[model samples]
Target: MSGLSREKLLGMYQKMVEIRLFEEKVFELYGQNMVPGTIHLYAGEEAVAVGVCSALRKDDYITSTHRGHGHCIAKGADLNRTMAEILGKKDGYCKGKGGSMHIADFNIGMLGATAVVGAGLPIAVGAGLSAKLRKTDQIAVCFFGEGASNQGTFHESLNMSSAWKLPVIFICENNLYAMGTRQSRIMNVENVADRGTGYGIPGVVADGNDVLSVFRVTDEAVGKARNGEGPSLIECKTYRRRGHSRADPAKYRPKQEVEDWLLRDPIKRFKEHLIQEGTLKEAELLATEKETALRIEDAVKFAMESPYPTPEEALEDVYG
Candidate 1:
């Protein structure tokens, strides 16, 4: 909406800062042996999530990747419940069944994230098919990594979505690497967004570090989808500041590249933009940071106090 007013820009900055701080706290907690399982921290590429989700309606469905807590938060999922899910507490969104990879809030339209690379694409397409069949104007968005672009699921899902003209937005969070492999080495194509053209869909590439740019492009695509236009693909060129997963130290990547991306931190860029627009006052920004810290601290306490699921409930969600 007119390149984001001052208040709106401040809100965007706050969300990005919140995501960064949450991930930093998670990293510390995990090191202290407070959390379980492998974790994927979305520390740097926050603008992509905040920008895309801002243009979406509450009822619009979204599928997330392993590095998905940022997306979930951006889509309005409760921070306490998300922290609980990551901590594997019964009070979590999936009652500790989903863990970090599977945390979801159906009420917020986050249709669960998948640990398998590119698997969520088809799921989003299936959701899109249902929306199409039901004649609902809702769109489904899938957040996937650059590594997932090479999978068979990516190809099949895009083909199916193209044939059906489903209301789906395949958002490729091309952060330049797949876990540790370089995207340039794996992908010979000039651009990942161009893949949508082969599927007979529209493709748009936006600067992932620029919140306003991403918001503008996503708004256009999402609006088109809501108006019964087919699907569109958005390739967000972003980067992750930390290791891909908790187990990964990301040694394979060049040191210079890491330093380069760190310089382009999405949160910092958004903060600067807000400041330039006279949106976020220094005092107000500091207060918001304090609030975010308090919320995360309380979430940790809630997760710690919540009960773990009983052993008997393990076989419930599965079918023979």
Candidate 2:
């Protein structure tokens, strides 16, 4: 918060706002049956992804979850290509092959996102190994939900990452519920970050509602990784505004919880900060929203007009 320059800080705010709007657009299209498949939105938890990604270099890697749209956007993926992919068009990043969950641009060191639950863990550890063996200071980040943390792969991945001193960060977006099961029913520990100490690494919690808190904590962890300090586990306490997926209505979640988190919305907080700082004028914020709307409209047009990839291209990009 203190160290980040005004430009960088405002850029972070813009990215968060973009994610909120983009997810809203996706949800709208899904309701209208425009999107090809299901989507897991990041409407309420924008701060976690944006804050963590902001601390990373372009070369640093991040493995995403089913709710990966915000991650892609925060990491600087093109919205047009992303929207096209979700719409299953030829102009998509994966030529319409990969949809919302699997869309990725490895050129930006995203290393692809996984739709399978808890699958991105080992991949992240492997990326860390690759970086270590190559004598580079790069790090790989694995973003998963609380449900994933209970998986066997999660345990193995974290153990191996610590044992080998791999340059990786395990970020648990503990949104208080895994799909429909409440966190209290599943996780014994109130704080997931405390689990890191068991693996001989740093464990910390951040105010997932506050982007600044996320940015600061991740900056510390990432700086440590860059210095060969090995992997760390960070549990971001947040909530998902939308349901588990497009199909889920999130009836299991209590209304009180949702309302509580919504009161501390990341967008509102960032806007308040910007307003108080005098960097974000009322007109500027309104115009930004207008421009974002136009851009999303253009993305839809591009995707609709683009042709589906030919059958021959199906065999293409089959390998890693």
Candidate 3:
């Protein structure tokens, strides 16, 4: 909200709402046995994706985690195609093969989402290196959870990117739990960003729930990366409202913790902020919500109406 134009602020709000609604709809469809496979919903962490992507250009690259619908939507992927992919329809981004865990739209610079925990780090590093080699200022963003931070790929990618001054931004969506295990139990450090010191890059932390806060930090990081300042480790302290995946009930988490995080729901908080600052009226916000919901519904309709891939189609895109 700080010095942002009215249009940008509204656009951010719309994106956050879109992500939230899309995830919620996916949850509903999955419950109805309409969606195939498991889904990692991005309900509570909408701000992180919208905020970071808002700071990036359309051509700027991003690699996402298994929980990546928010990332795809934020990066400007078409709603119909993304929904179709989740529904396993032929019109999907990956032609229905990738499903929920592996949607990619290169036109929007959404390189892809991989299920492997820390795999995106190296891929993002590769993208940054490509940009550097081509003498372009494009930067790459890698989105991973706290659990992946402990992976070898994390440290190795950071070290390599730092040494080469590749334009990369490593974003750690620390929602406190790596699946069911809490961050405190797995790692000694309180903040994941602290690890940046070891890699010789700036380490920063931001409120993942606060869209403006996230945008500010990411914007600054983007500036640094584009100016050839190398990579940065950004740890956004946030929480996932739902269980780890569709099968997880998240009983491992304390009931009180769930209640507290629900109270801090990113979408609700941003809505209140926008209203309090007079940036948007209540009716306008409601209208945006309604419009977004309708858009998501249309995407679902599109996906439902789409045909599934034929049996032999899977062998078409296969590679060694």
Candidate 4:
């Protein structure tokens, strides 16, 4: 895929598989009431996070949406910590405080995920400004849904980043539905990226179901931003295999739509591609799957065994 090294391609596959398994396990745990708080599963959209983060340097900043587990894993955050965080164990990245929607690891340049609809946009814009002021080649990326596009923060951040030529990439994971609302019912614009034209920045779309396609498009955007070309709007058309959040049921979605997206499952498609290209044997792919299952099991065990944060910790890390 795009002449990427065998290692990198396999790594991408592993990350996607890891996220899928992690989320699947989380889903099961939630059903069992083992996980606290509601969860927004990233099961269907693994390709977007893996593909884009693969193009990013470790030092580059990324702001995540409520559904951010995939982003954290793709950005090299410790899976054990992430899983622990989801389980609300003290061993978690946030000491069991952040839960599933707010996992953040600043060391990896993951600013954190906010459950608020469009809040991360301005934070990412600020990070981009910081990079520009520091005169570094580092860039900031903000991941949001099509629903957030309507927020004033989105427009304002894009305008500011464009005006200042800030090194930021605005990625819209247009998964068709914002919660239960389909994009067509909410926004008039057919393509979200087209809105970027008003800000005088490059607007592009990629196949979110294809990891390689996402990587190729994001690489171009990251390169442009690093070269001081300002912000870009990259819309990755995707679909979420699950409902908006836990217990959503998503009765509004049509059977055919769900079926169509199932056929485009990113992880399955990537595995098939790797085998067809002779890059990996079926056994090798199965081995990766087995390894991922074991890893997830270990993470779950670690989370289950870890203690919860002390009550006093609730008072820490708080602002008046």
Compared with the true structure, all predictions reach lDDT values of 0.87, 0.88, 0.95, 0.94
Which residue pairs clash within candidate 4? none
Better of 1 and 4 by TM-score: 4
lDDT of 2 by residue, 1-320 (tens): 36678778778877898898888888888988978878899998999989999999999999999889888889888988988899888899999989898888998888777789999999999999999999999999989998898899888998999999899999999998888889889888998888887788788999898898898899998988989888999989998887899899888877897888899998888788778877668778777777878887887778778887788888998986
Candidate 3 lDDT over residue span 163-196, tens digit each: 9999999999999999989999989999999999
Candidate 2 ranges with C-alpha deviation above 4 Å: none
lDDT of each residue in 1-320, candidate 4, tens digit only: 46999999989999999999999999999999988989999999999999999999999999999999999999999988998999999999999999988999999999999999999999999999999999999999999999999999999999999999999999999999989998899899999999999899889999999999999999999999999988999999999989999889999999998999999999999999999999998899899999999999999999999999999999998799
Model 3: residues with Cα > 4 Å off, grouped in runs: none
Q: Count the backbone clashes (under 3 Å) in each candidate.
A: 0, 0, 0, 0
Off by over 4 Å in 4: none
Distance from true position, residue 132, model 2, in Å? Answer: 1.1
If both were scored by lDDT, which would come out higher, candidate 3 or candidate 4? 3
Task: Give the candidate order by descending lDDT.
Answer: 3, 4, 2, 1
Q: Which rank order by TM-score, best down to worst?
A: 3, 4, 1, 2
Model 1 misplaced stretches (Cα beyond 4 Å) = none
Error of 1 at 64 (Å): 1.0
RMSD of 2: 1.6
